[model samples]
Target: MSNFDYDLFVIGGGSGGVRAGRLAAELGAKVAIAEEYRVGGTCVIRGCVPKKLLVYGSRYSSAFADARNFGWTSDSLRFDWPTLIGNVRREVDRLNGVYTRTLEKAGVRIILDRAVLDDPHTVRLANGDAPISAKTILVATGGHPMIPKLPGSEHLISSNECFQLEELPASIAIVGAGYIGMEFASIFAGLGVQVTVIHRGDQVLRNFDADLRDGLAEAMRKRGIDIRINTETAGIEKVDGGYRVHFKRGDSLHAGLVMAATGRLPNTMGLGLDEAGVDLGWNGHVVVDEFSRSSVGNIYAVGDVTDRVNLTPVAIHEATAFAETVFNDQATPVDHMMIPTAVFSDPEIGTVGLSEESAREMGHVVDIYKIVFRPLRYTLAGRDEKMLMKLVVDMASDKVLGCHILGPDAAEIVQMAAIALKMGATKVQFDMTMALHPSAAEELVTLRHKWEAPTPMAGSDAAA
Candidate 1:
């Protein structure tokens, strides 16, 4: 008989932890998962799932306007924030049930309370009667959004609170130009709210290709969202009409709400990682090896808590790789290279492989192929919105080092492109493929010009 209560004790019901626990149990090992809140964690409860639903809700204004240009008649458009929020909550609740039931059906015990490390191999539950022992313990507690320490910060909201508001604000000032901030800006603007975005950096989506970033910024400006770059918030105060956001340079703006999406930190505080001898990074993320094993041999971590690749699919992939290595005797290590990612802001963004700057810095002589033109749909609709398609190719090997797109369905197109990039597809191969005529994506295959190497690309200053 086994010496422990279970083979695995997973502390987190997030995507990574739950996937690990379920797969381990299915592999015939005893498993138990403990979660303090809802089982779906950030993605389902308050992150991607709810955020995407809001993105969809916010797009109807454009659709309504576009329909008229397409010769389709429509009724007066109205947006009900409460109704949308209520439905999104229902969907989240249903997903929570599904996650819980999945674990139970897999014969994995589910503990609906917080669990922390008592030692390398012991888990102490906040509300349970006794400590649980397991051969291995996995920490996948995920992360929470953080705001800067400014005067009257208590009045500011984070992404978590944005989901729970009773009513939509008439206007909002968002600090931080990351994907989260930009996404909220797009959503609020689409819903007819006055939106202002403030960022200390000169550009939004700082990690993306330069052209894509600037294109998105121009698009947001064209949509009437005011973007103030290289600015910092000094304080906030409740005012007569709403709130006043004071800037460091003695400027201010009045809005009904202020949101901070600066960044997220791992949810590892007070979980006893130190006492268990698990090493963490300066920013409090758990430090793990290639196999996702922590400093302590019997303890492991995955997902945002590890801070390697914070996307939900990457977390899920890491968990599957963890289970296979530990339980199936496959000794698998997750391949994070060339992982495709998307930003769901207005006009969207999808990218895979290295950015052109990174590729060049790595000492690759690159060939750039790019085009910016109004999509065919906008031609008939009489809109000036532009779509950008770019490819960064390693000239030496002829391999497509990166694919970046900015426009409607950019995320969808990039997801398919990721598969080809992962397979080491070459620029020649891309050219050999037939174009699906009259599609925004067909531009991917039809580009003919190779941009000269000596000509500095626009927006490259921010690339570094």
Candidate 2:
């Protein structure tokens, strides 16, 4: 065939690269995947896997409190950070081994070294291995947390550092109110740490359904979390006790640790993408076509490195499509629409499709169905927090355009909703379906009334 050492050379052994490598090798392609760190990439390492384990561990604190209302009594309660984190790390190690075994079983050559593009189809490994050539190259480097540039910013740590802390701090100040920051805020707060979340925006979870965004914040506040909105950070400085997060306007806040969870940038740097003629977007994202093909004929990219969706499942989805398209000769493009997503915050959030704001912006005359009530589980536990369930439907077609939820098991519930939305299920179909008794998700089918939007103020702009 082609004059190359391998059929595929995948850089960055994250989810996408691993999936592509395995699938391609399964199809009898000579595939090699390179990951500088451990395999399983961010999700299995410091991202979702470890973070979700921490979420599960953090919830025990609330569960213990709630158990008192359920007639369970315990005079002494203690949490060991070392035990939790150590167990989590062990699980991560297990997953890494699982992923490695998967690649090996699929006949993919795994390279434990950093790989850079020498040309469009040639790669150079950092461990002084001979340069390898392949017919096709893939970039799936993923991303890293973006720490803000300000004076004394060096004092700040990120989500990755959260897992590496030797001991849990007495208090933590998380900068940014995105999903990552809010999730950690929930974690630390649950673990009995005094936690403060600071964001420059006036609201938390920007771009989510407005009801869920505001409702979650209020519930978090009631749980004793200090959420500082419209509060800009000037810098971080070392203080006598710990660190002070200086505000751009008023009052500096002190904490044992300061974390910057503003956002993440694509890990497209220092990999010689430019030298290989691959285009990068504003945030070092590998610019690729719908087929994930780069400007260089045989070069392609996916996952957070391409910045499309940025979810681990999405990356795996894209990688699967890549393998099917390239090796199996099936021309499949990724479908980004109606993807369900979740935030592991205090009450949790799960949403699929468009928000009401997004639907309206797209010129959909939407009828919003929204309900807020304390969950049945919360009543017995004496938890005051409420659940928000909302649906955005196109008035013209009666088609359900969005589903948003904030409550326990929201993510689980939305997974079912995502299937409905993907199949273009209508409001009438949702209505006709019998709701399961005594479940929060049945609210999706039970909602009958349309929520009325508040009329615009006399001087304020709504038409504008």
Candidate 3:
């Protein structure tokens, strides 16, 4: 055995773990990362990369239909599901190789085995007989999809399993209405699958502004997705050729395939977290402080394992901040404010900062501005699609509280607004900026009317 095993031992070769290991090694620390699965983890391997590719592939269906209205003619289009799946798999393999090489280039030793914490400072590899010692340990195992207990849920597929399907179904019934569920609904709808989305909640995307959520539901419905809100899946069964999904909202639905996109839970089972004196939340997520330091001083946790913002970018940010503070002695904390996020539905949704309802609940007098109009390109193309833009501002300070968009390139456009919000830009500053004519983004700077204002207090109440 080598005299020095490692200075930092990171479990789970995910975005946060890989980043932290590389950065620590670059700073002259002996770092090693252990991962039993693919090095690129969920985002590059199965989650974000493949999911977006499917979303892109599926969108061609609608594009082909919309082309006719744009004065274009084409023969009947055919989709080869296996070919698309093969291409996506190839891309994921290339990324996995890149991630592997990156760690070696950064002087990080890679251990291809599950890591079990023997102590706060020691980790034992599941495949190896020897135990590795380190000064600091990090848990970044991330999360796994949660499939609820239904009578015949075993017959249902998961988000992870969806990518490996050899053939695309003609129709599908999806359970849940979170981001994952809605994203899949949009993807399948675009791929020409008759999609039925059943959710147990009153509205989809419960975290987003109610207006945007409702608008997105309406848009998806218009695109031919059967959205069943406040609905519950009673059971599933194997039918003659496919699966039969029995659901109850106000009615029932039968589909070819039953998919559960309910949500994801942390992958913390059998990791020996309790044995190492680490505390976990009720849902099995490791508890950590602002700097991602666990209950055990020498142990740290980040990524989906912490149950913090589950976005890959957020985990990367947390990892970078943790490494800077712990190794470089730089006292930096991650700022969750104005963290822009996107939902890759048919009409993409993007937002930064607080929602209108959240702003009002925070005791701010909000001035809401909204614009719903078709873009110039759509106008020329003779398409019926309309884009929605909303701005929430503090009436007293004129500070821009939030920005939201639902339309094409919404993710790309909202990123710029996120930067402005991060820099503390106000409504006046946004309004004063020159507009880009005939562009969808120009709507941000040209909104002339306020949608609502907080009610003023009466004289007696104000005096009191």
Candidate 4:
């Protein structure tokens, strides 16, 4: 028998930590999981789940507009912020209860307090409980949105605060152009608010493929968002009504609200990682091996705290692998490659595998197949919106390298494509597949011509 009180002690009741703890207990190991906040963690509490609900709420305005084209005489429509906010909060609370019950049912001790490392094998609870001893400890404290320090920065809010706003502002000035900033911009604009986006880069979504970055920016602008690229906020000042955001170019933007979605940093501070001698990255993310093992053999970490893949599903995957490796005696390593992802912005974005730039940078001559066309749904609605789909292939091997889509249901479409890509599907194989009739996805298998390079957009960084 082990000399410790528990076989596994998990810090942070986020997706990864909870999964590992529950799995270990089900596998006949003593487990205890601690969380200072709600059990559902960031994804359910403030990130993907709540955010997607808001996205769904925001889309109804467009749905109402399109309904007229379908001979529906619906009128007298309105949106109530309080109703949506209250509903989202209730859903979150329900999920929290579900997560807590799941742990209890699995026979994992649920400690509703913060757990910090006392040493390699010991953790101390904030509630003044006796120090918990375990044969293995896992850190999955996740991350928090980062707001940069500037003059009058106290007036700025992060994405975490966006959900709790007492009332939706008439106008909101977002202070970054990354996924969070762009997504919130789209959400607010869709709900009939004036939105302005400020970014230091030339375009938004900087890390995505160039086509997606440019296409999304154009589409957002067309939808009435004021996008100020190649710009940075110098400071903020409280005015009579709201806040005045001063820019580096000696200009100022006044809005009822200011939100900063600049980035996220691992929540590793004050966790006693330094005294425990676990290695961390420069950004304070716990450094772990492919198997999620830390420098100290018995101490491991997963999820955002490790900074490998910040997606919630990826964290769960790592946690499953860790449990199998440690408790089940089956060595497993989490694979992080070719994961499918989505951005729930206006129009949406879905992508998987290497981007064209990265594929070319790796010395592969690429064949690009791309199309921009209106979806069938827009034909009767008379909406001028267009969807973009592109495939990047390695010319020499005909291996599909990337699939990117920016349109309605892009996430659902790319999810299936990810399966084929993961299975090493090639250009010839995509062509050989039978097309489903009258579907946007059928376009994937029907395209034949290799795209000829078009003249680059003026002042654009995208390659031909």
Off by over 4 Å in 1: 453-464
Root-mean-square deviation of Cα positions for candidate 3 versus the true structure, in angstroms = 5.8
Off by over 4 Å in 2: 453-464
Q: After best superposition, candidate 4 residue 271: deviation in angstroms?
A: 0.4
The reply for model 4, stretches above 4 Å from the true place, is 454-464
Candidate 2: tens digits of C-alpha lDDT, residues 36-119: 999999999999999999999999988988898899999888899999999999999999999999999999999999999888
Give lDDT tens digits, candidate 3, residues 138-187.
89999999998998999889899889898888899999888899999998
For lDDT, candidate 1 versus 3, the one ahead is 1
Each model's number of backbone clashes? Answer: 0, 0, 0, 0
My TM-score estimates for the predictions, one after another, are 0.96, 0.97, 0.95, 0.97
Question: How does residue 215 of candidate 1 score in lDDT?
Answer: 92
Residue 255 error for model 1, in Å? Answer: 0.9
In angstroms, the error of model 2 at 31 is 0.5
lDDT of 1 by residue, 147-183 (tens): 7999989889999998898898999999999989999
lDDT of 1 at 155: 88
Question: How many steric overlaps does candidate 4 have?
Answer: 0
lDDT of each: 0.91, 0.91, 0.87, 0.90
Predicted structure 1, TM vs. truth: 0.96
